[model samples]
Target: MSPNNDKETPILPWDHFSNWVHAICVVTFDLELGQAMEMIYPADRELTERERTNICYLAFPDSNSGLMGNVQFHFRIRQCPQSMNAHTRPAIHTYNSNCPTSIQIEDGYLYGYVYFRQVKDRTLRRGYFQKSVVLLSQLPLVSLFTAVLELVAPEYFETGEASLEAACHHLDQWPPPTPATTLNLPLLGTLIQVRIPSRQDKPGASSLTPPSPTHTMSGPPSVLIPTPHETEAFRVLAPVLPHLNLLWELVITAEPLVVMALSPTTAANTVQTLVSLIAPLRFSGDYRPFFTIHDSEFREYTTRTSAPPNVILGVTNPFFAKTLQHWPHIIRIGDNNTGSPSTQKHKLKKASALKTVEQKPGVYTKYRPHLQADKGLVKRLLKGVQTGRPVEVQSALLRRHLLELTQSFMIPLERYVASLMPLQKNISPYKAIPSLRPFNPDEFLGTLEQHGPHLTSGIRGDWEGLYRRFFRSINFSAWFNARYQEVSDKLAELHLQAVCDADLGGWVCSRSEVEVVDMVLRLRSKLPRAASLPPSHPARDKLTQHLHTLFMALPEDLRAVLHAS
Candidate 1:
């Protein structure tokens, strides 16, 4: 439709009609260094350079008028190596008549948009590259397949193919999509496989808490924490932090209680993850405070032998209630109103009046499975939640309930991905599975042309990709909120212990905060199109400045001194 492309008339009805339209919009790129673009689209066979140019010409007839809104792709291309030949250069070439143009070629992968519109002006110049020439010389198979596929399944192949063809043609845009983002956090569960001190020796080494020379050996607090009537009715288990040559972390008066207050799921996950990592430890005997509270006079009537500080235990409703009264700032563990004064009184009364009953006849039983993949178990868990007799139990029962809920939600996610690529069962079907290696620019374009329809539909969730994985969706706020709650609770507990000091009596300053630094670093490494981002872009400049400031803010002795302190 462009003045340049107007010379060519469609040989076939398919060519005359708008089979597919693609809009290539590049919002952010660092042309000089090259970058990778993050794109979400379907996959298919390739197209020729002429075909690609034709697609782009028709898709974006006017440089002034952009493509459709929905069809957007984000990716980066590697910077083209110096002394670049035509093969190494970008496939798409444009001579914009308006602005000063700079040529930056990445590994020839272009990041932009592809729009499939109904009608548009056909007045644009055919781009530099020709689909026929590229197909014949560079990508024969892809071009051939695309042609065949277009004939066989025009509806199935054109749209995604057109977009990819446009992307391939525009490879000269200066960044190749390859690298991805990584938000680094400590590998949580991966730690179990790591080298660690023996669990048994850890307790002994940790138990060697030197007696305070400056402080007096005070007896346990006189205030009697309400004793549970049915102590033997339920067994409780809690996770002890991994011993890294440090004293046993005290969660009670150790830190402020405000930190543990997070959503139920988050708090539960934090407790579970922590529990999974460390050996189980229990708390027995009277629920008594470690430090004695005096009321003006030193005389105490209800003193008792305090338990060793090393043991870790779950705070039951009663224990949770008593602890809150003593340590007013104790972080609430779960989303349930356990800490809310109004809610606490009710739960306390509920805890005091408890009973264990036999299972009802003809009732279906559901047990949580060890792995999330068990479909049978998921069905049973859902059934039980829907209809089951309630049992008054310990934290383990609560955990089991939550586990069942989590597994039920996750199983469907895995099954959905599996349906996408039945041939490739190893990877999740829902995600945009990457090829093992970056495809050649020409060949990659060809592949897109062949399979573009499916890819675009897939990304839109119009087809299989929608059913793929929850993780694939760009909507991450819900998931992030869930995760954030979990991390916050666990971190709150860790932080409390980190700030506790024997001399200062809970005013101990936090010595180490490398976790935050490491998190930021990981996020930096995962930045898309980092290499291609220009020095002028606000995002690029902010990242650079933040990193600089981060490094400068650290004192020479910071790492060493913090750990030691």
Candidate 2:
């Protein structure tokens, strides 16, 4: 037979074909005379062997070929037992037959007789095609095989139905094959060779002639049977085949967008949810929903260091957000520090302070000028009351004037009082204190006389402490000045950095444009209003000009956004 015999033969309909295009079988062999012998010959074995033995059958319908009949095939392998010695391994052998089997549909079932001629010296070898055959057992196409079997031999079905509807119902329960299985097929056309007789042979030479039962051909040997391990694996994965197929479809078509959950468990649950949700849609066409929580597995699918992510869900770790930012397509959810309580508190405090600054304009200017004036008045009033006999004037007038002054500058005086107050045990500094009521001159003098010098000393000490605390607490000017200075310094630093970046070729140089723009925007936000700054302030003018220049120098698209804002 010619080596190209299989390729040269015209493809034939299933019923007309002498041999199968694809086939698989389960065979048992034992070692004899340093060779493996076929314990179960193809046709010599009873038909019951088809059911009792572990076998998988697959047949593809060629819609274009107009062949209603299915092509029946079998898998065969032969191997010698290995030697006990660690270094010594036995050689494997495959036997091919020259006499092709003729399969016929009888009683809605296919029956075939195959004869084999054992190739003694030919070593068993595997190529891409042979390996693919073994892999087919694990694929969704295995369902197709079972479906075809049920169609051909419905009586053989465990369900005891011999109708096409019954066969299709059985197929519905079978798991769909994995994408991998459907995708990989060996050079199937080359699996079997057909011989065509020349014109000199006979008048009907064009017709294929069945091989004599006695004749056996020698050809390449291969192991077609799946191992026990492979059978178990397929069985284990069969239930999930439908889900795998759904996910595969989603991935291939880029539907619903790829959402990578940071956790493996999350990913698994997400996949399950997505499969169920999209199952009803039943969108046609091939799609692969590929997802992996393992970083290594993700890397296997991506060619770049930064992969575009459609959506990033449940990324609680700020570190993950930082890493994911490198991906150009990542949809930013929010601040990375959003989950941090301390960060939130800091932002809240900053926001409150900013709001206060905006609402209470010139807070420092309003309070600073009166500090010295208020201090002098408080000292004079206290000194005058303590030293004067004050027999004619009532204490009520002095008390009312003191109350008015304290209330007039309540905020500043409160700050002063808080600063001077000693840290008292079991007392919170933030606690509120009640205001003192007015007292008449007679009432005050009578209490003073009754308590004598000790009362006088105590009252003087209390008054001094109150005065000190009130004075210290009224320094809002200093606080406001410090806050403004800090903000100013930060703005200056940002402006300097922006200038340095621009000098070094702007965003094109080391720094990312996005990061640079973020910095610029932050600095711009911190910039005080031109009206707030003194007319001739050099810093204000410099900042304004610097910001305008930076904004103008930005890319047209970014500049447009900024200008629009």
Which one is best on lDDT?
A: 2
lDDT of 1 by residue, 441-548 (tens): 344223333443333222111212212222232222333343344444444333222222112212112323474345235324534434344556555555455444
lDDT of each: 0.25, 0.28
Each candidate's clash count: 62, 24
lDDT for 203 in candidate 1 is 23
Off by over 4 Å in 1: 1-87, 92-136, 139-511, 523-528, 557-565
Cα lDDT of model 2 by residue, 377-463, tens digit: 334434544576242132223223323433332333233334333333323211222222222333433333343333312112233
Per-candidate Cα RMSD to the true structure, in Å, reads 33.9, 39.2
Model 1's lDDT to the true fold? 0.25
- TM for every model, in the order presented, reads 0.16, 0.16
TM-score of 1: 0.16
